[model samples]
Target: MELSCKVNYALLALLELARHRERGKLVQIEQIAADYQIPDRYLAQLLMTLRRCGIVRSQRGAKGGYLLAREPGQITLLEVFTCLEGTWSHKQESQAASLTQAHFAIEEIWQEATMAATAVLQRYTLEDLRQKRDEGQQFNPMYYI
Candidate 1:
């Protein structure tokens, strides 16, 4: 499954928020954009979408920013992907196929593929991603003096 740049940016921003979740800190869009080298305006729009979808909450005025609306462990990747990508549809299907055994077999394969993808997506949460990311980062030493 290919992910759009917007979805990737959203995931990066959420992972950053998940990293800071323990502190109950509100992370500003500019910080997220700068950290990931994404456009601030675009990230803002994505964050707004997430906010509208109830995955995130926004604070106004000075010291304002965004925060996850729920625990990172409570938010599944499926929920985030669906909120960003909407429902899945077989747009590649051109027309209805003839009701033959071969056609049914092909349909069953597609159905199983979709179900397997959904099952994998639903198996993880933002916290899981954060943990994996942290684990991977541990081996890469920082270059600060």
Candidate 2:
């Protein structure tokens, strides 16, 4: 399955927030956008959506910005996915009544696949991602001139 650019950007934006969550400082949209090369307008829109869903909170002032509403460990990737992408079911509800046995079998397999993917997503929280990213950074090989 392909990850949409919108969802990818949302996750990256969240990761940025997660990284700074411990400092209790709000991260501005421009900083996140510039760091990840995401468009400012698009990231703003995504952040608003996240805020509405209680995944992140926004402040309005001279030093205003955004911060996670909950800790990174409390937010699952599946939660973010559902917030941005909606429910993950791929079944065609309208076609359910017309399916033949062969179609039913194929659909059953599809459902299993979807469930597996959902489980994987649910198992990972933003904290898990942050740790993985930190580990990768630590293991990267350096080439000195």
Candidate 3:
């Protein structure tokens, strides 16, 4: 259940785009990389993957940059995750055929966990994440000597 660095960088890039989505302005990959400290080359590759998956779009020219393909509210975390990680599948058919009762029980529990995780991912969208980030930014700690 560990999150991959690729997915994390993708999400951070997406979040930056989600923030600028309301402005209707394209954000360049270098800007996103600088903002989040992601490597420029790696971010470019991730954006390309996202573009191919229909999660983001790119524009070419002097003003060329990237933007989300759909509204932030319309893009679910599950969709982003699947785009980067590929679709989730259970144990292979060959492995399943060799399982005993104990193994079957363990597999059932694993399936349940996977389903739960999927449900959570599907429930939230990029807009939701943006809102959460905004909320966190509103808090400032006071230091008194």
lDDT of each: 0.87, 0.91, 0.92
Could you tell me the TM-score of candidate 2? Answer: 0.92
Model 3 lowest lDDT segment of ten:
88-97
Best by lDDT: 3
Per-residue lDDT of model 3, residues 1-145, tens digit only: 8789999999999999988888989999999999899999999999999999999999999899999999999999999999999967777455656878887787799889899999999999999999998899898778999
| Candidate 2 per-residue C-alpha lDDT over 1-145 given as tens digits, one digit per residue, 9 for 90 to 100 | 7788999999999989998889999999999999999999999999999999999999999899999999999999999988999876666565667878887787789889889989999999999999999999999898999
Model 2, backbone clash pairs (residues 3+ apart or across chains), number: 0
List, residue by residue over 1-145, the lDDT tens digit for candidate 1.
6888878999999998887779999999999999999999999999999999999999997899999999999999988989999856654344556366776687788788888888888999999998899899888977987
Off by over 4 Å in 2: 93-98, 143-145
TM-score, predicted candidate 1 vs. hidden true structure: 0.87
Q: Each candidate's TM vs. the true structure?
A: 0.87, 0.92, 0.91
Model 3, which residues run further than 4 Å from truth? 92-97, 143-145
